[model samples]
Target chain A: MINRRDFMKLSAVGGGAVFLSGLSQITQAAAAYDDFYFVQLSDSHWGYQGPANPEANNTLRKAVETVNGLELQPDFIMFTGDLTHTTDDPKERRKRLTEFRDIVSDLKVKNVHFIPGEHDASLDNGAAFKEFFGETHYSFDHKGVHFVTLDNVSDPGASIGEAQLAWLAADLAKQARDARIVVFTHRPLFDLVPKWDWATRDGAKVVQILMEYPNVTVFYGHIHQENHHMTGHIAHHSAKSLVFPLPAPGSQDKRTPLPWNPAAPFSGLGFREVEAEDKPFQLKITEFPVTRA
Target chain B: MDLQISKGWKIGTACLAILALVSIGAAHSAAPKTGKERVVKVVAKRFIYTPNEIILKAGVPARLEFTSLDFVHGFKVPDLDIRVDLPPGKVTTVHLTPQKAGVYDFLCDNFCGVGHEEMSGKIIVKD
Candidate 1:
């Protein structure tokens, strides 16, 4: 059953007919499903040093602490992208990645999935990301849900491209129409704002492939703010960055990082928890602030 | 005899004037200001460069003043060996004179983020 809090949150975000339909399906499938949960951490931006986030160093540590403290253990953890701040030197990049890996290794969950943010993959065109995280784009199945992680950021031009698109099409062909699909990528597939560099160059093509599926949800990072959008029946949700926040689209003249306030540490930064159930298929998302203001 | 001498003098004077004018023309052609240094203000953010596409006359000198709106970014035009490191909130200037008319690609050599590789622009030099 849909709770009032979930309804309020969904309504506030303009969760349209598709979301409502999904909710109804979940309600009907309640008896046939087993519950499981996962955590999503995005834009940790490790190795980032600046006043924008005074606690930048501790940001990932704090997220780890929070995840460990969860009363209900998460089945896994997925980091959306922007794992590091980015550096030109190869040695430095490796160092940052190693440090980030070491820190996140402490996570209680063993099944952790990582996708490269532009900062991590754009420099060497996914070489570093692949070296460290294995495949840049791949799929996995967990509890009846098919999760597809794509490498959009590695292209430098921010495109899923032909090969990856073909892979996606072929991969989707194997799944039944009733299968629940969750897509993960670094950038928004639709144009959020071209001027602000929020839109992926060839994202429309990727969307076309995803449209064939009835139950498809896309989660992405890069905008560094919690946002929701819809294309056809598909719902797109952008998670908040673990490090710091950026200005809302066109909120300012420029898409600069939001200045941090010393008075309020880790105010607008946090991670998301997603609870999923089988049978009718239900996924409920909850966002937690790092520090309560 | 007097008329012939005057004619010769007149010709010599005219030749000297012609030489003076030719030298001045040569000097003007040699120092023709291609166009006042084309100054462009570029703001570098996470993974993209603003004013990414730059157009300049072939012979014109260009000055790009780059300021990072976000992180530290490196502006590099390898063809011209023009590179500048842009630190947040600081303006870095790069000077270039396009000697040839061609399209030159510039990119952020410093990795800014996931989009850094795609963070590039074209410098179109027109004759």
Candidate 2:
């Protein structure tokens, strides 16, 4: 439901006509567009076997079931990263990636997107990840919004690199100042926490380029918990991990995964759906649990 | 409220404190000791490490003294199970004895700057 604040924001950006129009007219105007929503599932960490998540083998399958159960299936589903756990053996890594791919293929929405997390790409410089998921970075247009995916994890040092930066700059050059742009990345563009390996090495440069556009939102997942922050006017949102939860940034000395509580299974594992409508770009984010309570 | 301690109680408390201190000292002394210490001073900048290739004798303890010239950096030898955080303007030291002779790659695990990905080194442990 659009509250008073949301209405004011919509009216302000919708121009003077929207301001003069009655509330009923505004509702009609909002419904008169091809709005779309997409699902985001991140850090599945498939093939991970540990005490932190006793049901690691089944979590990803259950998440697929949950998404399939959505009353309204998203237009597309995006996996932010960590499709598979890190493995020293290249063959094992590919095996895990194949298993993860097979599990996610059951999604009702065949149109899916993916990016790499450090666990999936860093060891072999994205060779295995690329083999399975095509290019590490690319852009696509859906409905009235533009979506760009950046690879920050392929490089072990957690950098987006100069080449990708130039590509992003050129990509943005074609769009209008107020164009609705959405960025999907595994690591946050802004430095959330460097010590814990939470921030991207060259993330500031990427953020600088993104700051040029007025309407841009970055959706990322690596911290394994939900976090929201803003750099200038750009909003950065991180999603929860399907494997296990981590403590808040800098809350403890070590960034260890929070131990699984037998009483509350799958407490911090889930995915989210983000709905967007243009005209005056507005977003509605709804989070869904991987399993019902 | 008036509280008083008897001489016997005071003596017992003093004895417990002394025992605890002695135990702690013994534990400290039992910790691993660097044998035939070999100091290797390394410097870190934006995305490079000075003397990136290091050579050490297997079974000989080496003290790695790391200093970051610019931002905070990290030294992580994943296979060797060694990780250290080097804050700028400070000396962070790590000690290890290479029991096996092999080439172990080490990288700056911390995100320094733009060129951080290329910041890596190797330790050649000679038999």
Error of 1 at A287 (Å): 0.3
> Which residue runs of candidate 1 sit more than 4 Å off their true CA positions?
A1-33, A278-280, A291-293, B1-127
Estimate TM-scores for all models. 0.68, 0.67
- Model 2 chain A: which ten-residue window has the lowest total lDDT? A16-25
Report the lDDT tens digits of candidate 1 across residue range A138-236: 999876678999888887567678999999999999987656788999899997865456777678999998888778888888898888888988878
DockQ per candidate = 0.10, 0.08
Docking class of 2: incorrect
